[model samples]
Target: MGEDCNLHEQACAAVLAPGVAVTLDISPKPVRAMTDLEFTVSLSDRNGPVDGAQVALDLSMPGMFMGENRSILSGLGNGLYQGKGVIPKCPSGKTLWRGDLQVQVGDVTGNVWFLFSVK
Candidate 1:
């Protein structure tokens, strides 16, 4: 008797199916140098504000090592969010700076990278 009997493989294939993919969105692209930096995020294909989602912000300066950075936000009602943070400036060292923003909700994640100069 020469017959293939791999029923387990067939069962596994039947149960497994493709799932939805996660994507990131950030508003106010092409930021500029100013008093404060602000932006918004919309959950792609996800209903709701994605409560308790974690956001990471990093700042760097031209020709200099990265420095002080923080994250703060204000709830704008109905799943909308706004955040304000500080970026440190150094003279004779780093003037122009760039920022990196990372947002994570469950298994989904997003990122924003922007550049700005100090006045």
Candidate 2:
């Protein structure tokens, strides 16, 4: 598991290609479970912000099953996509969750994971 991202303090980013990168930003800060969250996903390249792509994110816990929590985002132009979703609180008191961001441009698809903790 890629447990390097801290989505509470800042946006976590991962590279797809040499100059292409994807970032996952969530708010309001100090993410908590069973609350509405605004998800902002961005894709950029050497030229600039890449737009007109289908973007979505699947929220899950590493090494555990937490049902299906997916957020399908709409393009807000300039490579930024926004969506709303909720993170369900775990019964086992698990704080760690993974935001599996999926980016699709044309027929090509890419994925990146952002690890975060819920209060």
Candidate 3:
């Protein structure tokens, strides 16, 4: 399946599964291409931080292939995960990119998508 299709599937699965709230914080807002991008993923459920969960980030531009830019995040206690990655410049000059944050804790899985522009 294409990346876009896969992303849609993940979003749907996340909705159908138990609610998993995700909060994202990207450093140096107004992210620019070919630059360092740091992000923090915070996972939480009904109880509290979903610690020890496997978290990963898939960064891509819709309809644009720039290879697979995936990063595995390190769990920082209290439901917080951190990772860094660089946004590649789009050959088509598209500045908008989609970030898919996938979280998996045992049998439960959740996904969150965010749109950001590259200067």
Q: Largest lDDT belongs to which candidate?
A: 2
Clashing pairs in 1: none
TM-score, cand. 2 vs. native: 0.92
Compared with the true structure, all predictions reach lDDT values of 0.44, 0.88, 0.73
- TM-score top scorer: 2
Q: Candidate 3: TM-score?
A: 0.81
Off by over 4 Å in 1: 1-52, 74-77
User: For model 1, how does the per-residue alpha-carbon lDDT over 20-83 read when each residue is reduced to its tens digit?
Assistant: 1222222333333334655453333335334555655566774676556656444454444456
- Which regions of candidate 3 deviate over 4 angstroms? 1-17
Q: Which run of 10 residues does model 1 get worst, by summed lDDT? A: 8-17
Residues 4-100, model 3: lDDT tens digits: 3332112212331466777666665556788887778878788987898888989998788889999889999998899999989888888878888
For candidate 3, what is the lDDT? 0.73
Ranking by TM-score: 2, 3, 1
Error of 3 at 1 (Å): 21
Candidate 2 vs 3: which has more lDDT: 2
Assess every candidate by TM-score. 0.49, 0.92, 0.81
Write the number of the candidate with greater TM-score, choosing between 1 and 3.
3
